[model samples]
Target: MALTSHLETLKKKHRDMSEAIDVAQRAPGIDGLRLADMKKQKLRLKEEINRLSN
Candidate 1:
């Protein structure tokens, strides 16, 4: 049950990261570098989720 909840949280973070990237794209003033950092964080979260599932 804990694993299931963790997986769900990771999925939600992934979705939020995706939306953030999209928003960054649409905005001219936002720092692209910051968006890239968020994407990296999202990647790490996915990797952790995979490790936990295994």
Candidate 2:
């Protein structure tokens, strides 16, 4: 049960990070490195969620 709740939270964070990445991409002069970092973080969270669920 706890794992399920934590997984939900992680999914939310990943979604939020994805939205942020999209918004950043639309802005002028956005930093590519920072966006890449966010994507990495999101991927980490996704991996963790998968690990826990399985």
lDDT, each prediction: 0.87, 0.91
Regions of candidate 1 where Cα sits further than 4 Å from its true position: none
Our tally of clashes for model 1 stands at 0
Clash count for each candidate, listed in order shown? 0, 0
Candidate 1 lDDT (Cα, whole model)?
A: 0.87
- Score residue 22 of candidate 1 by CA lDDT: 87
The numbered model that scores best in TM-score is 2
lDDT of model 1 at position 20: 80
> 1-54 in candidate 2: lDDT tens per residue?
887889899999989999999999999999989989988998999999889889
What is the per-residue lDDT of model 1 for residues 1-54, given as tens digits with 9 covering 90 to 100?
Answer: 988998999889888988888888789888878988988988998898889889
In angstroms, give how far residue 21 of model 2 lies from its true place.
0.5
Over 4 Å off, model 2: none
